[model samples]
Target: MTAPVVSAADLPRALLVGVDFGGKAFFDPSLDELALLAESAGDLPVAKLTAKRRSVDAALFVGSGKADEIKALVQLHAAQCVIFDQPLGPAQQRNLEKHLGVEVLDRTMLILEIFAARARSHEGKLQVELAKLQYLSTRLVRRWSHLERQRGGVGLRGGPGETQIELDRRMIAERIKAVKERLVKVKRQRGTQRKARERSGVLRVSLVGYTNAGKSTLFNALVKAHVYAADQLFATLDTTTRQLYLEEARARVSLSDTVGFIRDLPHALVNAFQATLQEAMEADVLLHVVDAASPTWFEQVREVQRVLADIGAAEVPQILVFNKQDLMDESLQPRTDEDFFELEPGRSVPRLFVSAMTGYGLPRLRQAIADCREAEGDGLINGDAFTTQPYSESDDQPVIP
Candidate 1:
């Protein structure tokens, strides 16, 4: 369907495409999230197109017919680019770009672009560049015809059959290796810091959640530190940590705000951001923040869980912090401030409702963290009991207003 024209002259108009593979379970029917992603990447979505198929087309992904329809939409909307909700193969991407006569990007590229733009810290920028380079490496074939020309002359840089593409690929390979080496050093440095934290016997708590789920806001509230928090997707890329002193538990917790996760996060990004994500994996406790007001929160939860599992943080002790409680409808709001949420089969984690903006339920959330710290200190922390029995929904506990 045609999208209303946006008046922003600075934003490049884009056409969003989503293909519903009937058998795929991860299909986004409304393409609403894709539109949000486009906006996050500074693209103005002028139209949306969808197609249904049992499998992806070999050449254009959407096949020639749908490709033609998309071309029409692009012309109709005067779109400068077409973005697909699903990842496109290198060949498919190139072919689609050629046929549509506009830039074609898939979800992965769009996410990488956002990351490249949002990264502020030195480490964050390096990680983004590494991921982008890796992604570009695979699509180098025939990306530019000039790169296919042979370079062979007395004064030329290469011998008889060496082409520009080969030189470009070699340069990228060298850069990738260099970036990886630097990241290794950074990883080692982070390891040293984590070791120091461990020596202090302080609990490390990481805030992880779906993007724009108020994770940074909650972190700011808990630690009273100024972190860049906003309502936009992937607002902050750098991991910010601070010391949170709990008066009740008489403990100082190392609280860290991590980059938020999203559905279908690129593998290259996950690999590149390993140093940053290690905080969550090595945390003593994870605050899996959730936007209580979001209609698709359950799906968002599953996506975060999938990412957690990917990063080897699935078994980490997590306390579900349902943020933005003030935005929830009165009738739909949680009856209790603290409860247990079944994150997976036979696995229940402590859940608390809090509005970071309003400061409601923050005290009780602190109490929950203190309780976990106390349990850890007493050596009474049994994973099975901690997750399944003690705070199970079946337990009788007073519900806080």
Candidate 2:
């Protein structure tokens, strides 16, 4: 295992817990993704435990026996915290912490923490703050219930004190409101830029896919820009746009590299980043990049589609770019570099193989984009549609062998 990104000296040792409800073949028994998430968030996962349960236990989540086991592990390893791969209700979270005698965090909070740390731009920061506030807002309940002895006003009902809870709620609400208002301005600014691009009549394209699927790498490869690209989750939290010139089309298109999606992305987080995600939703076309070398590419593809549908970008025309082609086994390579692959039943889209790293089959990817632009000009996507057609490379361009 790798050392924590933060100073390894005193990094929190975390115990990871994941539950399988059974009958779901997609369940990861090893909790590898959760481990990656914890590592990305600066936690050192000292131990991991997986369990099978038919239903959730409201108070303890994994039930008393499993929680005891978790507590034993925490004691054995001296883990500073317990991290759950599933969402924990407020009561469940509080109960887990009390039972395990350590801090308890769920998948949602782990992701939000990573977002908070990685966000750079003002808009990105504001979005993360809003998400954290919204997420924390839900968890304010019963947390201060222990303060019943300090209750204000009335018959000493001896209920959890409302004064502190109300004050905290008010504070979060005010901050959330302020952040939202600021984000509205950000959205307007983005809309203004979008309008300017619309006026220019250039074809718009946005790169979107699962996190760390090489969208940023491919974006740099195509546009020749220096946007940060890394081999980690949520590395790029903001939208970056650049002009890409296609020689064959004799035209340039507005290309944007947007943040990546992930499994079980919180609704509040998605809602908070609406301004950033809007770039993908309103684009003329989407470059749906995928990790071609991944054995679970189909599952990843389905997850991306699910997110697109959630954000109302499901109808956008997409070009599936199977990236990391250089890493695929020779036996797995398709005879043709470009063809139509069925993204779902009755829906086939243009799929191309290209190595964003080694530049393999890039000529075909560029030609495919040119085809989309020309097709749009021909009222094809807006009227009929663009399909996989033979790509002819421009005479002036050098092909990557």
Candidate 3:
């Protein structure tokens, strides 16, 4: 993984730990992405440790020996925290904190922290708060040290700590319900807006891709709107929409830029952001932006597809916009402006090469969008346009080709 863009002086020092269980297929072999995540969450990674285990140790996820090694490294580097690349059980997490003598966090918490920091809009903040509350609800036992102590009072049937935990849990539950209700109302408002757009017969196109894949840059280039575009992960958290008037099709198309996806995205996040992600699900066409210059571009593509499937946007017709072509070497550049990419065994989608930062191949992208608009019009005239599929919840599954 690329080194983090943060200076050690400016960010809290952290030690990264990754465990390799023999049977797990989703583990990152290099643990570089974890470093990126740590940096994205405002942590400066000072050292990295990896362990190979047959299975997780019951008491500590990495066993006592590895824990000691990590502790030594933490002391050596003056690290303030240790981050694990995998999720840990509540007990295991508490145990790690006690053994290491420092704050311990897992990937889920790191992502949640980043979301909490990056959320800008009211709806975005509410969603992040809800996800954080749900995550925190599961680990309340570790938050307080006196959870086992008891108290006796006139109306106190339970221990003081137990009562506190119960009260906090109940408050969180109520807040979650309130947030969900507000989100439902927001979803209804969105649906009404979508119906209005549909009645006007405007084509909806959404930009979807992995985080930091130039989706926001492309959106800015296409519509001339200054939605935040930065080199960091998740530069833009809120979904922004604008109208793009296509000269070729002689029509104004609704273009939306939504949140980017990452590998091993938490289920709580996926559920919390459903109101925002519904833009992609309801889109007439998806512009799946991609970073063509990255070495792991294919893996990134698969990860984005997995999230799309999770959010019920897999079946939408997608046109892959391979962004950042200007950064690619000459030999790796595509010969044509547009071609077909086989995303799965039987699924082939249109692919276009473009550099959103430099306007290279952008005319071709506009032409492609215009072509899709024309095709939709032709289908409507012929009474054979593919009907939009009704959105439904489904179990998250790996998308195997």
lDDT by candidate, in order shown: 0.87, 0.85, 0.85
Model 1 agreement with the true structure over 207-231: per-residue lDDT tens digits:
9999999999999998899999888
Question: Candidate 2, overall lDDT?
Answer: 0.85
Instruction: In angstroms, give how far residue 48 of model 3 lies from its true place.
Output: 1.4
Residue-wise C-alpha lDDT for candidate 2, range 23-65, written one tens digit per residue: 6645777888889899899889999999999999998999999
The window of 10 residues in a row where model 1 has the poorest summed lDDT is 377-386
What RMSD, rounded to one decimal, does every model reach?
4.6, 6.0, 6.7
lDDT of 3: 0.85
Candidate 3 on 103-207: residue-level lDDT in tens?
999999999999999999989998898899888888778875465344445333444444666766677788899999998998898899999999999999999
Backbone clashes for every candidate come to: 0, 1, 0
**Clash pairs detected, candidate 3:** none
Q: Which predicted model would earn the best lDDT?
A: 1
Backbone steric clashes in candidate 2, count: 1
Report the alpha-carbon TM-score of model 3 versus the true structure.
0.89
Q: In what order do the candidates fall by lDDT, top score first?
A: 1, 2, 3
Per-residue lDDT for 70 in model 1?
95
